[model samples]
Target: MRRSLAIGTALALAGALAFPSGAAPLFSGPTDDIGEDVELAPSSDYADLEDGELVVDLSAANPEAEGVNDDAVTGIADVFRVRYNGSQYAHVWLTHESEAVTFYAGGEPIESEATNVTLAPNESIAVGLRVDTTGETADGLLDEITVHARAADPEDVAAQGDALSFSGSTVQTRAPTETSRRFTVLGASAGETTTFDASRLALAGAAGDLTLDEVAVTSAGGSVSLAVDASGTEGARSRVAERGAEALGAVRVTVETGAVERATLRFSVPRGFFEARGVAPADLAVYREDGGELSRLDVERTGERDGRVRFAAETPGFSTFVVAADRARVRVADARLGQTTVAPGESASVTANVTNAGTAAGEQTVSVTVDGSVVAQRVVDVAAGDTANVSVPVERDDPGEYAVAVGGVDAGTLVVEAENETDAATAQSPENGSDEPVREPAGFGLRELLGLVALLALVAASLLLARRRPW
Candidate 1:
């Protein structure tokens, strides 16, 4: 009878140890206590625990979960709890096969080098998760993360039973919520302009400074829906500075449903943003940043009202739009005349070298002035950090020496000579013909005639004297 009672007691103890409530068998062993020793449960912060698995929903209501927008990172703390239910000290860590999500324990990241934390008997720790969504465009699910636990001391024989546990939970992510505005074009003809107020698309948080007041779309006929959202200016300040401009603000604009022939966006500028920077309304420009390239857009000043200035830009497609003033330093460096001397009614070429030292491309007027009067002018286009030689042809019909200036700088003097005078000078030059000195043709003069007549009279008197003496 005593043997029977001992056998029954042993069986009860074995069943109790091997099949503990709310625990799963981790491995098969000779000992009765070979079972899971770590428990995973939902924390007070999160209550979506189902069957010892945690479920998280990243939404706007959960402000602690950040990075709910495009080109952002998501971080959430205290996602769940990990408790060691073993009798001896054990190391607890998390393992996952997800590239998008990383797990953390007790505020420390769980990497290969630093994976585990020593948890005493019945101690618990909080777990967190981080997701990098820098280029993530779609919403999806994160892979399951397994909670692992093992004995801290390898040689502890008593810790052999219930030494390891492998359990995990599933994570799901939703699309980032945004405030948007939609406009519908009904039976619109081609080249027709439809306007809509998008003031409701102002985003909160870091990009709250930017607001889209209105949007005008030039359509290509048919009905279409256009949805617009304003994302913040996270890295726009430095980008504008790279282009030698000052960023007032920036926003990401997206178009949906159909293609637009043209889109005009009107937004408000910060009070005194231009005045403080000494930028004029005409100096304000809009640029679209796409694929790491910035292209300039045509912008117009929409006037100022209520202490605020407004501007409009015709955008080519939709992307990140920035409002800035390009500080283009365009000026004339020097000027040169093709020739210092020119014939009357002939044209002289005046070349002006224009240099752009700023970070933007611009156009400048190069004028050729003769004696303080503008004789010719031209518009020259110069890119940033480049130089362009603009040539202006000038003509002068009058013959004179005139001081010439180009692009507001003195170049040199221009001499205009008459055609007849040029010909006469060319004829007198020795290089034109003979090497001998020039002489006049032979001719009789008054002095030679008078001497001849006197000689004749003397000869006649002598002949008459001789004849009278002979008789």
Candidate 2:
């Protein structure tokens, strides 16, 4: 019995060393001065996380000096370190703007893999850290993570002897942590009811056997009908009905383990659902459910709208979200017709300017009416608060006076006239209908009489010449 007790004690001590019991949180407060060498804040705000999963959180902000922008500090350098009871069970993954921030495991900057970020003096961006367990062994207690800040490079700081400040947080994981636990919503149809299988809920970590307590689906800023099937052999399933109005919303699923460890499942507002509700495809703001108001949630849009808007969200826990925007309204203006007069057998064109005087973009048809009858029409697409001219061609085959209108509004008139055949002929022949008569020369001048006598002499001479020729 003594030998067995000794072996058990040894194993327990070894396991404890591998997975420490007490560790700091996963985040630290902000470090204001990079030149000040300091220790990490040894407290954390996170209590639970799964293995092989990353939970990123914002660090606490350092108190700002009066009238000073803390983000203006130049050449800010960051160094990350993980402190534990001499076990490599956990590794710290650091990032800036979704890019890796570490070179090697020791918080060394990778020259090639480094992300060079420059923030404006007035602009600020938060650095992120992801506590990832190797999942090699369930050993945890990988406690404190310290992020050091400096005004210069590590080498320069070493050479120039500038100081650095650090902040830290504790990290805790559920015992026997699984690689991952995530839930997927499948077969969601936009503008229609969708049912998801509960049995297929992907559960990981120490609590793989997850039980659905309840499901509540509500619009972020709208309304929805949600139902959950808790009494099922496979697992808890969910069904969400279509929203009656166009708005952003989310479906939150509350789940529990046999030990009663609670976790919530959250998803972004599906774009297809919003589109089915007549929501225009514009930039949508994502918000996580807070107490009464929703807070912004960072998400990546998948740029696809099938039955649902597909997107990926990284968060510490499950929560509700709202994808929201102002609804757009479209309106048509009174149509105006231009250049309504034309001759017969010619085409007369009418132009009406279409305007969307509302906040929404839409298309409107502007028709041309001749003598209270629809003759020609055109479709005009106008953006919100914008206008476009729609042109319709009216053919005047016969002569008549036609009243022109657009969209039932009297705009102008179209007078088609046949060409005046009599005037046209008179213009072509000016002397055809003249009243003056033909007249001879006013006087027979001497030259005219001499010419006549010469003509008679020539006739007599020609006769004589002919007689002589015959002899």
Pick the TM-score winner.
Answer: 1
Please report how far candidate 2 places residue 196 from its true position, in Å.
27
lDDT of 1 by residue, 18-67 (tens): 11112233222321221254554443232233222233544444442332
Deviation in angstroms for 82 in model 2? 35
Tens-place lDDT per residue, model 2, 1-471, is 000000111111011101111122222333232212211111122211223112222222211111112233212222121222111111122222212122233233322213222211111122222222233221323232223222333453344332222222122112111221222121112232222223222221102222221222211211111222212211111111111112233333332210112222323333445545554445343444434434444545555433344444443334443334333343334554456657787887776666665434667676678888888767777776677777777777888888888877666778888878887566556377655543446977778899999999999999999988955
Per-residue lDDT for 237 in model 2? 10
Residue 135 in model 1: lDDT: 43
Q: Which ten contiguous residues of candidate 2 have the minimum total lDDT?
A: 1-10
> Which model scores highest in lDDT?
1
Off by over 4 Å in 2: 1-272, 280-334, 369-379, 407-409, 425-471
Q: Which 10-residue window in model 1 sums to the lowest lDDT?
A: 1-10
